[model samples]
Target: MAGKEGKGAVKDSRINPFEDTVQRLRETFRTGRTRPAEFRAAQLRALGRFLQDNKQLLQEALAQDLKKSAFESDLSEIILCQNEVDLALRSLHSWMKDEPVARNLLTQLDSAFIRKEPFGLVLIIAPWNYPLNLTLVPLVGALAAGNCVMLKPSEISQGTEKVLTEVLPQYLDQSCFAVVQGGPKEAQQLLQHKFDYIFFTGSPRVGKIVMTAAAKHLTPVTLELGGKNPCYVDDNCDPQTVANRVAWFRYFNTGQTCVAPDYILCSPMMQEKLVPALQSTITRFYGEDPRSSPDLGRIISEKHFQRLRGLLSSGRVAIGGQSDESDRYIAPTVLVDVAETEPVMQEEIFGPILPIMNVRSLDEAVDFINRREKPLALYAFSRSQQVVNQVLDRTSSGSFGGNEGFMYMTLSSMPFGGVGLSGMGRYHGKFSFDTFSNHRGCLLSCSGLEKLNDIRYPPYSDWNKQLIRWVLGPKSCTLL
Candidate 1:
């Protein structure tokens, strides 16, 4: 299910409960409590400990909320967050160091660099899908950057939300970290207060709402609003190999991932071949009855389950298309003969459903992908190196995968983010630290350089202007 940014209707006109929490954190931030690199490292280490200690509790919470399997939880959520934390810890000191900037002859004797400093009292609004990962991943970045943070985990994922609100804070310093829990109305109310920086993850429709709210406070935001990511299958590839990789990632976490291949773009002949291969792969991966498989997870909520159930009508059910509302389980489904105007085509199918839309050639597939809003991730499956290169060169996306899935997400060196409607800003690894920190350009000149700096003083003359111009000009640093 895609993350929801609820309308946040405040019916009773109740007071915002987050005022004290905000003020308290602001006070702590003002006191310079979170500024030291050592303090930041300690918080990050403690966060790692939180995950290691509560692995079982977290798994159980995920199971309660999404029926997420233990292995999937560890692979997708826990391990990924841990990797981010460890990476930040290992690189913290260097990341905090000021980066030296080249100097002109006018300021050649001055020390100039960009100091990365924290944006105090930030807010991280995480999504329900991959709750622990989404919530803590940014939390790790915020802490590493020395920012006191307030977390708003999706209320829909009550199990993980409970842990974040109750257990996670105990691991870190409460003065510098906090968790506030509520539904749409409460979140909207919380958004009313000003934050130094805001990080949001969810759908674009709600991204606008968050952006609008941030505008009032002039807060910088990193919005990870995911879209309907496309997966293009080349006619040159082996069907089974593509099917195994595609099916595994698409159905992983019951297709609740934002980066999962939302639909397939391929030729009619390829579609015909892929259907059977996908069917075989699905069976091999999850037993015939996917609902009984512990490896598979359930939809997050009744509303999302019904929405996905309705989307199954968009095309011919080429494979599994069963739904059990009682269990919030929708069978891993694939659709064929689907139209572009169908409901499934228009929206991000953040569920266990994949649709194949027929295209005549590679050119047509590229055009089809380009016509839509840029997605957070795009996948191309091909055996030929030229074909993968063509897709990468021609299309625009936040991230790309060739002959594979979202494995790029595992690499700390690579940035994970969206472009255009998918979302804004890059984060993950060093990018995360950079996103949370303010790069302040600084210069320190010697007090004894007053006589040497007199050429730039207000006493203007032809000789002084000529000297200042040449000293500050492009040729000053050039070789004679």
Candidate 2:
């Protein structure tokens, strides 16, 4: 079982293989088997067990696919996913209960609440960067919200894809969930079908295609796309402290992270000081020759390696700019004095390369950030709270980091998604459950309240109109 057929015992020819699977999932959803809180909790527990049982298998697959070390794999992918499963399991009962809402004067005697109902069948298309985390985290929400899910893992990450397709399905109820595998062609075929909901994580270009395909069936979608995230370094900060934080996140997973700081904004003087500090930090984290570092990950493929290697010429190399094509390795690199028109600055550099561009003041840094598409994550480093506040106040991003990196991801309380070009919608913990579930406004009234409702359905008269106005108007509160 290699390639797409690795999705359990299913086989893939030149034709569509998912037709039967999708229909079966929809049939399972119709049975209402997944709607119960106990069922959802049980599925979540099974997901947690899947993580615990296949920990070593997942780690090895990630290592094979991305050269991810055990520590990095655990921190970014496995642990976070496990925590999500645990959180959903702990909270599923409360999340499934109907929420009582405040009623107006006329409906005071009636029961009003929001019923969180599952969308029948869902499609989750995950990206390759954090394959397991991205795939399983969303799966937790879909399952917790009691929806049948069809998971499409990125085919580019072959090893992890294989593990997820073959091993993960054994944990969950096979009839209600599935792992569909393939490239763009397969995705296109999947998208052509009607689904209740679609959750996608990938590039903006492909996001547009997914959105377009979804428009045909009028299916709701959650597009977690990527953008060039900015990191602004204030002149008032300690160079070493800022460098260590920025470098650690910038090169994490060889900078394939969507939320990683893509570029640096600072004054010329600050840039000069920070460059040396960053050089020292990179050497410390990955060693003098990063190619020899077991902890450092390599680029995903030769195509991306060549693309990242091309960016090295965009600016003067202030730190590392080394590469080895045979090994698919690029050192944790930093480039300074980069022009705004350069390719590295223009695009999201999803590699270990970091570019630094000069801005005269905090105002300029804010202005520079605003001129571009809003990013998924934005960072402002300053010892002064006011400076950090000023940057936050002036700019918009999906998430903000003040004097830190992407540590906010660790907390399930915060949402993880983008705004504008970065992406749309959000997910994580309760938000994920909410995203998957439809909040239906519901009301139950007395069957014998016909006389009370007659005031709203009538031929016009001055007295009746006046009474209706009094009942529906803002002054109804005053009457109450």
What is residue 216's positional error in candidate 1, in angstroms? 0.2
Model 1 TM-score, all chains together: 0.95
- The 10 consecutive residues of candidate 2 with the worst lDDT sum are 1-10
Q: Report RMSD for candidate 1.
A: 4.2
TM-score of each: 0.95, 0.97
Give per-residue lDDT, candidate 2, residue 315: 84
Candidate 2: which pairs clash?
Answer: none
Give per-model CA RMSD. Answer: 4.2, 2.1
lDDT of each: 0.90, 0.91
What is candidate 1's lDDT per residue for 61-152, written digit by digit as tens?
99999998899899989999999999999999999999998788877888989999999999999999999999999898999999999888
What is residue 326's positional error in candidate 1, in angstroms?
Answer: 1.2
> Please, what are the lDDT tens digits per residue for candidate 2 over residues 88-162?
988888888999987667887888899999999999999998999999999999999999999999998989998
Model 2 TM-score on a 0 to 1 scale: 0.97
